[model samples]
Target: MIRIHEVTRRFGDTTALDAVSLDIAEGEFFALLGPSGCGKTTLLRVLAGFETPDSGTVTLDGRDLLALAPHRRPVNLMFQSYALFPHMTVERNIAYGLAREGLPRAEIRERVTEVLDTVGLTALARRRPQQLSGGQRQRVALARAIVKRPRLLLLDEPLSALDKQVRAEMQLELKRLQHEAGITFLVVTHDQEEAMSLADRIAVLDAGRVQQVDTPVELYRRPRGRFVAGFVGANNIFAGRLLASGGLDVPGVGVLPAAAGDAASGDITGLVAVRPENIRFADPDGDADAPLQGTVLDISFFGGSSRIAVTVPGLDRPVLLTAPGPAPVAPGARVALSWHPESAVLIEETVETTVETTHG
Candidate 1:
């Protein structure tokens, strides 16, 4: 229900947003994800009317949203700090906005009561913010924002303050709350896990531009560009030239398996991206001409899986492999790595700059 068209914002010589455009469907849970200073929060502020763009337009339901005042706009921004009143009780804090808007006393009471129950804070409605935990305070902030029944809700790092355990719980809570409220939710977060778990669709931003916008699965499986591939998840990217047979020719790694659809005929150079989970340990008796053979550098075990780092002959960095359950091979063991041709995604680079490689 929201369309942001070519929005550009600048602070002095630094451009915060550069011709950024996005479409958020009605009742859709969307996320603006990027690292620090990638312009995600700036874009969110532009949508909420807190920051005016130097150029471009914003529309909500086909109406010009920029023309409306912050308070007049049918949108609410929940700050990262939660911004709850320390002195006021939960119900009173939630009802503050409605009271200021001159809503009827009875209507305010009804709305606050309903929202308190919706957020499962009915029993603690009379408790002060200091009395509540971080997660509870977040719910109160959410309750306050939704009490207005906004057409859109903008959340800025909504779960950053909570511990890892509480953060996970609140992630599920946030998704459930958004679904129940039927509001268009646009959350800004640098946490990839948060965005992937809570948002139906995510827009990955980098250098003040949108790298790609897609569902969590597509963003993980088929990243359209180098930044998206490198940022969204753990990917082993090989810089190489594309062969006529639809394979990537890495200088020292030899020809790695890739899909022909990654590039048309005559394309010279591209990137081959493979996820660790997609790579497997080839049997010792398997093809000796395997594309990659490495010495297992080290292995770290998580509860459900193991991560093995393999030092290849010609690669500057070790190739990572994820095995289920336990370490399949001991450290310093010779292992052959293989993956399906279709598992490798070809990313045709459009820029000369390089993305920082991530090690799992």
Candidate 2:
């Protein structure tokens, strides 16, 4: 288990981390997720003992982690570049750390062989880094990190260098390795999909502060703020004032039904966020009183789903809608859209926020 309390780090005029706090469960796969320059990597480095926090404390199982040096701490950092030695073979690369610790030759040999088997690199043990594929080299790097059996392993953009297909494969591989190794894994990633798929819980960081920390499902379904809602996935946001009748009232778009969560009274400023998949095309003849109407602006097909962008009358941006398979609606067709009242989330934050640096 690890506890990071009120950690702060600064770089000249910019604050890299500002009063960030988090608790990572033992042997849990946790992820620090955010955009570029959001301080996720800075926090990771602090945990790895590469960077010191200006204030606060870091503890591992009640031990003062900051008191130990980088090599003295029971932690290992796997860099993004893999940092493999070109001249050394895979076995030698993995054994380099154990050798540096002055372990016996037989023990180093045994540990290297076992780790090679764990990473499925036993067959290519004699091959150099140049002879290995990108994914294989990644395995080598992972093998080198895990062979030490540290209490925690820090991975910085672990899958950023791999191709899409390889990245997907390694995502599953990384999870399996973590479970098999029984080591706590703390991964820093800018990719939302990677964090969602690999981490049991994620901490969303922005501008040197922690915005929200929750399970992947909770973070996606019920975002605590506007930044979490927009950064986690594709959402249709409607900025308006909260009405007494449990809805959001826009100047031109009228009242949109939303679930008023804990907001007992109305007349407050808020926003309603809806996902594309939650919106449905209503039958114009049957449901004569559809609240929202728009013209289909464009449609894109992605094999399993079709994305339809509808041009609403008063909204600044087109409302995105997703449907299964090919939709029969054309570009110029008029359509009515509707979603369940509970499907919309009422964000009470009044400030305007832009998620320009977010990566999906």
Candidate 3:
């Protein structure tokens, strides 16, 4: 297990990580996910002992990692580039760490052989870096890092270099390898699908802060606010206002009958976020609560699913809706869009702090 307590890091005047803290459970495939410059990698590097925090401590299994040197800590970082030694063969590259630790030749050979097999690189142990493909080199990098059997493994964009097919294969391989090794893994990735598919739980980071940390399902289904909803996936929004009570008053999507969350009675301005898949296309005349009756402006086909862009009156932006199957809707067709109030989420426009009068 690893715990980061109020960790902050700065380079020059810009803060890279700001009081970010989270606990990573042992054997959990934890992912620090965010877009570029969001400080996910900084947090990983802090955990790996490569980068120290300006404040607070990094602890692994209750031991203070801040006091330990990078090489001294029981952790290994697999770089994005697959940082394998080009001059050394796969076996030697993997054995390099063990050799530095002054292990006996027989023990090194045993570890090298064991890890190569673990990474499914046994047959290619004699090949050099240039002789192997990207995926093989990745396995070599993994084998080399895990040869020591460190208590924690840090993977920095481990599959970024691979093509789509190879990346998917490696994702499955990584998950299986984690179970086999039974060591904690902290992966930093910007790819949303990768984080959703690979992580046991994700810590969504943004601009030096953690926005939300939860399982992929929780993140998608129950996003807390504007950023989480928009960042996680495509969401259709209906700009409206809340009435004096807990009722919705949309100019176009009218009184979204069921109230959502804790939208205060007097707050007249708000937005509704509904996942594209949640919005179903229905016959306008058939349903009474026709929130959006629109002309289909654009339609895109993706074999399995299709996206229908609907243009509703009073809304400036087009609403994107996703439906399963090859036949969703055609462009320029009229459609009715409806959603259960409970299925949609009402969010404050942003995460900004509003001044509240907490009684003098």
Error of 1 at 239 (Å): 1.3
lDDT, candidate 2, 292-340, per-residue tens? 8889999999999999998888777888889999987999999998888
What does candidate 3 score on TM?
Answer: 0.91
lDDT of 1 by residue, 144-208 (tens): 99999999999999999999999999999999999899999999999999999999999999989
In the range 1-360, model 3's lDDT, one tens digit per residue, is 888889999999989999998998988999988889999888888877788889988888898998998999999999998877889998999999899999999999988888888999989988899999998999998888888999889999999999999999999999999999898888999888899999899998989998999999998888766667778878765556655565566654466533643445455566557787877887888886676688999888888998778887766677788878775567888888877767756655432222110100
After superposing candidate 3 on the true structure, give the runs of residues whose Cα lies further than 4 Å from its correct spot.
Answer: 242-247, 257-269, 349-360
Per model, state how many residue pairs clash: 0, 0, 0
Q: What is the lDDT of residue 176 in candidate 2?
A: 94
The candidates, ranked best first by TM-score, are: 1, 2, 3
Error in Å for residue 214 of model 2:
0.3
Looking at candidate 3, what is the lDDT of residue 105?
A: 99
Off by over 4 Å in 2: 260-264, 351-360
TM-score of each: 0.95, 0.94, 0.91
